[model samples]
Every structure is written in structure tokens, then in C-alpha cells.
Target: MTPEPNQLLRPSLYVGALVLPLLMSTSALAQSAGGDWSYKIAPYFWGTGLSGTVATSPALPPADVDASFGDIWDNLDFAAMVVGHANNGRFGFSGDLQYFKLGNSGPTPGPAYSSVDVAITNKIYSLNAEYLLKTSSTSEVWGSIGARYWSVDAGLNFSAGTSPAASARSKNTWVDPMIGVRGRTELSGDLYLVGWAYAGGFGVGSDSSFDLFGALGYQFTPTTSGIIGYRWLSVDREDGSFQYDVEMEGLMAGVSFNF
Candidate 1:
């Protein structure tokens, strides 16, 4: 006999309730064990370029208009993240919140003939259930899958000389599935090396697009680590055309704490 619709929903609801509390309790226990939370912070600098129809606009003037445009366009791309982990011997879990920002001066010679600046920012939060494949007194490897919530905003500013400026902004948000793998190796008694790669996608305002990032970290203690790394991101715009693409490449640094 087939199960009723209500029965099917009940089982999933029960499973979610059980799993969520168990994960929460485990994390709380880790925090009390000298495995308390820790944090890391890093900032990077980079350059960006625009392509497609947006790049080909006739409003922008020539590229060599001002030195300030060159400097602003090439500088200040960075990402920041904070993460927390909880683990028993063989299994553990982690959650992270991250932010990234990129900006550049649009090429001159567009229809406006005024200098235009573009800035894009992304914010993401994720929770993952992890399984430790292997762990020794000195090293560990793990993999995970979970859910992610993300928000992105893009803004454009137009300015002429030192006068007033005008701007436009667009924003989007979505939830997606996420997965990752991470590993750590002891370099010495108090020092360790760590690395990870995470991939995910969101469907909002456009067809689902994915993001992938890799990072490296150095452990200061069993519960705390400092990290520095790079991320490359590509997104399909909501414009419904092949002519618009949003891409980002930059450096990132952050910290993680295990509880």
C-alpha cells in the first residue's frame, strides 16, 4: 500500500527536528571543552574588467581620462569570512558567513562620456554536516554537504569632473545547495596547515549559477586558525541574454574557530 501524503511529510519533518537539535547540542559541547570559538580576518587587493554589451557601451569616454579612475578601478577587491566548527571524534559540522566586494571604473567613451564606477558585493551564509574520513593526533580530513543563503548587490555610479554624482543599484537573493572538502596536516606540535574547496549555486532572478572557492589556513591552536586564499566566481545575469556576464577574481583572508 502507498503511504499517505501526510505520512511522508511527517517523516521528513521528524528527521529534520532530530538532526537539527543533535547538531546544535554537539556544537555547544565542543564550545565548553576549551574548543571554544575563534576568529580570523584578511583583506586583499585586485583589479577587474567588464565585458559584453555593458562593456561596449558608447557612453564612456577613452580609457586614459584620469589617473584616479585607473587607481580606483585596479584597487580594493577583498573578502572576509568567519566560521565555526563542532566535532566529536569521527564526525563534525561547520557553519560560515562570508562577504566579498569588487569594484572598477567603467571604461570611458560610453554614451555618457562621464566616468562610471561599478561595484558588486556578495554575502553568503552556510551550514554543513561533515564526516571526518580520517584523523590522527596530528592531522585530519573531512567532507561535507549542506544549505546556503546568499545575497548579491550591484551598483553603478556616474560622475563628471568633481561635480555631483548619480547612481543605480540592483540586488538579488537566493538559497542553494552547498558541498565542500577540507583537510589539515600538522607541521609541528603547535602549527598546522589546512585547505578547503567549496562549491554551490543559487537560482534567483536568473538560471542557477555556481560558485567555487579554495582557501589555505594556518592553525594557531587546536581551536583557532588563520587563513589566506583566493576565489574565482562567475554568474549568469538575469538579463536573459548571452551578452551579459558577471565575473570576479580576488584574494581573501579569514579565521575559523572550532568548538
Candidate 2:
């Protein structure tokens, strides 16, 4: 039997269903543990631009890409992003999920070429265990370690003159060990500064991946807050005939709820 074109997305979707429930359960568990347990959920948007190179075949050189946020928005077919955090005492857990599909078309370089159309699907999941080094009313710092799972499916189709259309597809999936640090400091009564950074890969999984995020937040209520921030992420991977090197950076905004 032939597999469906979207079959590549099932693993992440199934895992996400299982993990999201666990994230919700953490809040109840934390609430039962004591006053020390705290849980937060945030839904965010990242206006990311893509910049890098991609190669579908060894015979062809990698194509350079520089896409702005508007380009991605124009090409985006679907997207979802959400994050959750829970802590009890000095021990805590964090989970983040991101998934998207994009499509783009461009004219071929020379007269012999008509047009090239491309589609990309990406899914990433991050789960971490964290430990706080310092904690106070005004400030706190912590470090975390976990795994990051990545899956990407890409396809290209093109037609030139009267020739039949040609198409190619590639898929890559891997898990990497990730480590990072996060901190928050109070700037005033209801305002705070927060930052997080992490990296994964060491000749394992993909060649390398890193992320940086920072934000300023204002508490609207004891249980809710609004955040504005910036984020940058980069990834490099090479597996047989598949190769992808990309970076995304943008401004972000979100709202967080505590329970």
C-alpha cells in the first residue's frame, strides 16, 4: 500500500496528543503537592524569517534562501505554537511545541525553466527537567536539560516548457540532547524581565541547533500576564542526501496564564 502524502506528520501529531494531556495534568499534580507548586501556560506568535540553504540532491548545489516574515506569512499553510511550565519547590518541568507548513513558488533562473514550487512541513517538540539554583521574591535562576525532537518533510516540483513536471521529496527526523538556562527578575511591582537560551547537538542527531529568547512581561492580574519578546533559532543538519541549514529570528508576543 502506498502511504499518504501527509503521513510524515503523524508521529508528531500522536506524540503531541499524548504530551498535551500530561501538561494539563501537571497543574493538578502541582496544586495537590502544596503551595509550592505552580503551573503556567502560554500561547505565542513568532514572526520568523527563514535564511539558509537547502539541497534536494547531491548533484545540485544547495539553494540560498532569504525569506522575510512577510514571505513566510504569504507561504504559510498552517501553524501552531504553545508552551507550558510547572514547578514544585526547586524541581520543575517545561514543554514546548511548534509545527508549521509552508509553500512557495518562484520562476526558474533561465529561459529554459518555467517555475519551481516548494512545500515544507516542520514539527519540533522540546521537554526538559529543570532545577533552580537561586529563588527569591524578586529574582530566580535555573538550568534545564532535555530532548528535542525534530521532523521535517520537504518537496519540490517544477515544469519547464512543454516537458512533463518533475518532482522530488525528502524527509528527515531526529532527536537531540538539549541543555539550557532561564531566569526572571522583577523590574517593578508588576513588571519583570525574563530570558532563556539553549543548545543541542554534538555530532548527534542534527549537526547543531540553538535558541535564544528574551521578554518583558507585565502582570495584568495575579494569574495572568502579557509578554513581548524577541527570539532567534538556528539549525544545521546533514543526513545522506538530505541537507538543511537554516536560521529564524523575530519579535514575539504572548499571554500567559498561571494556575
- Span of ten consecutive residues with least summed lDDT in model 1: 61-70
User: Which numbered prediction scores highest in TM-score against the true structure?
Assistant: 2
- Writing each residue's lDDT as its tens digit, candidate 1 over 88-205 gives 6666667665655555565545444467776666676678888988878887888988887767666667776544555656666667676778777777555556667766654433
Name model 1 segments beyond 4 Å from true.
1-79, 108-115, 136-138, 158-167, 188-191, 202-217, 237-245
Return the lDDT, model 2, position 201.
Answer: 81
Q: What would the per-residue lDDT of candidate 2 be over residues 222-249, giving only the tens digit for each residue?
A: 9999999988888899988788788777
Supply candidate 2's per-residue lDDT for 67: 65
Q: Model 1, residue 36: what's the lDDT?
A: 37
lDDT of 2: 0.78
- Model 2 / residue 84 / CA error / Å: 0.9
